[model samples]
Target chain A: MIKLKEALVIAEAALKMARIRQLNPMSVAVLDARGCLVAFQMEDGSSLLREDIAKAKGLSALALGMGTRALVGRAKHHPAFFVGLSALSKGNMIPVPGGVLIRSPLDAAIVGAVGVSGDLPDHDEACAIAGIEATTYSWDAGADPS
Target chain B: MIKLKEALVIAEAALKMARIRQLNPMSVAVLDARGCLVAFQMEDGSSLLREDIAKAKGLSALALGMGTRALVGRAKHHPAFFVGLSALSKGNMIPVPGGVLIRSPLDAAIVGAVGVSGDLPDHDEACAIAGIEATTYSWDAGADPS
Candidate 1:
């Protein structure tokens, strides 16, 4: 279970990384394995939709048991399935790169997921990874390092 | 318009109030007038559904143009209408006392709403009001002072 303290730590670290990178204002959401929000923060300048997008990315990762980065290609190849999935989830599944799966470091057991939005998708994913790295947990963005 | 900074202030103050009062761990959600989330936080031990309940309370206030305290009576009298409204909102509207309408101090215009959950309904409502009081804005729980 992802404790609320750990979730807040991940969210704070992600926002701090965004600031260091001088990225656009961002919103970050952390969700436990059940796709329930644990901690969420939206920067002052974030657009209204950023909150929903951030949470949706996290939900997508949790629902699919894979980082949203992997879903991008699958979504492109199977548009109907993706669309139906989004509707079924009440628009909570967004297939994008910023959603990352959190895993227990010792056994690689899935714990939760984090999602970030506002910057480019890749940059958002990087921030999410940076946030998870600050903790003892591990993160998967679903793409082998190239 | 409610800034993210203000939203966080409301959430943090609400949680702090809950702790000071020795109430149960709580979840807080702040939503702009359009019913979009601005900030949210769930205490470490909060149940998974707390986040949804908190946000739904705020959405209920925003959608009905009144604090949820007022809606409770109306809902009891008009169960079918309340039920339909909840379905129309896709389960976001929850008529209960923990939801409070936030008003701009200057003009009394509704700026947003705040919701708190995890304790007795009256205690939850009190925390929401306390959080709003910490800001320059005003709050309405839909009941006149006795």
Candidate 2:
């Protein structure tokens, strides 16, 4: 199924892209519904802090149903409410970019998501999209990295 | 002009670039000095756990004038304090890669920050570098990513 292994593929692709573009380095990860690490990948020279980013963003993508970046705007309109969410999420709720929902394009059903950084917010989001886009496996049927 | 927006763009570019190159995906967050939302991004399928990685890493990066990733290394060697910090931050003070200070090139100052995830400690650091390079952004003069 579309489990942790799929997360690994996304990470591998992200890291490779980072190097080719010479955009510093990178760190990546995948998580399950409970926000636990399922699949993870980190480029050389990336820092340990990145691990947290990957986990947090990945979770955000799934929880928010929107990219982490989108949350920033919504949080602004409702400061108090956003803060409450931040607390409720145990500091895991981030309204930032670099995170997107992973779903079955065919049916548009939510499946998983990816989070990225090591670049700018937009850059992180872009990479995340790319990571999810190039997957040859089928989330509906569960598959391995292609 | 290239303040928060610049930072976000740089981070996103780095993430996408990294992913395309088969590197690691990353989680990145950008914030203003007052901890306002500047920009944010997360890769796709990043799992649902790392939702708040950006906020935690941003705090560390802004708090210190170095790199959050560095703190993770330190934490490994000194779990006692990290434990306390973790409790103090309530899981918001995540010390990991892809987290760094943002500053002005004209004058080294703690203006903003960027956090990343998805790779190993070293790799996260590299991705942070890519973000900085691609965007005319730099770490806070004395800010630490941790």
Candidate 3:
């Protein structure tokens, strides 16, 4: 398992790459292939809760093997489903911004994911997107990490 | 900062007090005085995602300054409102079952939270309830940690 250091490096670089210096302090979490946390980091001044948000976002993306953004539309069609999952998981099935599927060049398996918070959805998503770009994973071939 | 160890102790004690001995592997998460992770424990054979789920629940409760149950009503009234939040936080908000705000004494300023996931919602809730009963804290009546 590649440690989350790679993802955190990407997340931090994305913060700078996205010019997020003026944004609210942020938090980012990375999960392993098994969906366990590989690494978690909170930027200075971030809301303490930013962490939970990040992890939930990442898990949502990972479990469904889809970007949380797309999950929103699915939830729209099946509100109860996501709602039920939200309850089942106790509320971490957010289908929103700031989550991305990570993949690797070798075999193109999804390495993990990155979830971001402490800013607007768009900005938060922007950081995550930037984070992906910082990784070695090929974003063009998006697929679930098995 | 009360380690998640204390929180885990509470969680396990809660389960024992409730007499739940492995309906499913359970995950427990505790946050600190500053709302960071005190500790996170996922029982073996639990869902691969249990630890994240558990911690994320606790994180949601503390971040929102409400119980996971309260979010259920909020989610009902404004399902659409949470969509954006899901995006912003990146999908880590559970509003039901076995999630709580870990707080200080007296005014109950939130110090942290505990999230439990594994069994039925009621059973999970029982674990969290047991944890709180066993955990103790000290705070100046009117003081806020933040």
Candidate 4:
């Protein structure tokens, strides 16, 4: 289970890495297994939109059972369906990089997802990966979902 | 100026107050001034709906710049307009008794909002109020707006 405290630590770690790398101000969001917000942090200089984007990205990762980076190709192929999903989720389906699924390192069971925003897409994704690594949890990049 | 750590404290306090009162499982949400979620927590037994309700309540309070309880009377009077607002917000408007605006105690400037759900309306409101009181910020029950 992705405890709330663990989620908070992951998000904080992600933002810290962002700062350490001198990336633009960033926001991080963590969602529970049920796709509900657990904890979130917005750096003081981050734009307000970063908060929503991070949340949407995390929710999308949870709903699709894949990382946001992987969703990009699928979304591009099924643009209409993806747009419909955004409407259904009330604009929460953000199919972009920076969202990654978090799993228990021991068993590989999904725990939750973490999303980072407010920097270049790849940089945001890197921060999310770093955050997941900081925790005992492992990240599922959706490479081989067997 | 409400940081994520403070927001988490408020939400956790609201849930704790609910437990102390022996109320039903509850979910609490805190949103920053820009109307983005700062923290959220759902009790172990809370229904899934509680999460959505708590967030909608906080978002409504932020969008209207008043407590949800205060919005109830106005919503009753202008039912059509209020309904329209729900659509505009993609169903985030929840004019109920459990949402309260948070203001800086010293300056009373709007800082954020807290929302609680999954118990009796009055009980939820009480929990929200208690949580706000537990913090340094003041609760805006929509009195003395000036």
Task: Choose the strongest candidate by lDDT.
Answer: 1
Q: lDDT by residue for model 1 over A79-121, one digit each (tens)? A: 9999999899999888779999999999988899999999999
Which pairs clash in the backbone of model 1?
none
- Tens-digit lDDT string for candidate 1 (B44-75): 77876898899888888888788888887788
Cα lDDT of model 4 by residue, B22-63, tens digit: 999788888888877777776665666887898888888888
**Tens-digit lDDT string for candidate 3 (B1-146):** 46656767776676574455556777777776565777666667786778777877776666655667667766665474375455444566675667776666766566667778888866776677777778685321111222
Score every model by TM-score: 0.91, 0.50, 0.52, 0.81
Question: Model 3's chain B TM-score?
Answer: 0.81
Q: Count the backbone clashes (under 3 Å) in each candidate.
A: 0, 111, 12, 0
Candidate 2 CA-lDDT value: 0.62
**lDDT tens per residue, model 4, A35-144:** 77766777765666887899888888888888888888778888999989999989988877898999987887888998889999889988898888888899975542
lDDT tens per residue, model 3, A30-100: 77666788777777645456777788878777877777776755676777787677766656777666777
Model 1 TM-score on a 0 to 1 scale: 0.91
How well is each residue in A1-146 modelled by candidate 2, as lDDT tens digits?
25766777777777777766777456666655555676777665453356666566677667766656666556556656666665666555655566666767677676676767576556766667677767853222111121
How well does candidate 4 score on lDDT at residue B65?
A: 88
> Pick by TM-score: which candidate is best?
1
Clashing pairs in 4: none
TM-score of 2: 0.50
Every candidate's lDDT: 0.88, 0.62, 0.67, 0.82
Chain B TM, every candidate? 0.94, 0.79, 0.81, 0.93
For model 4, what is the alpha-carbon lDDT of residue B141?
58
Q: Ranking under DockQ, best-scoring first? A: 1, 4, 3, 2
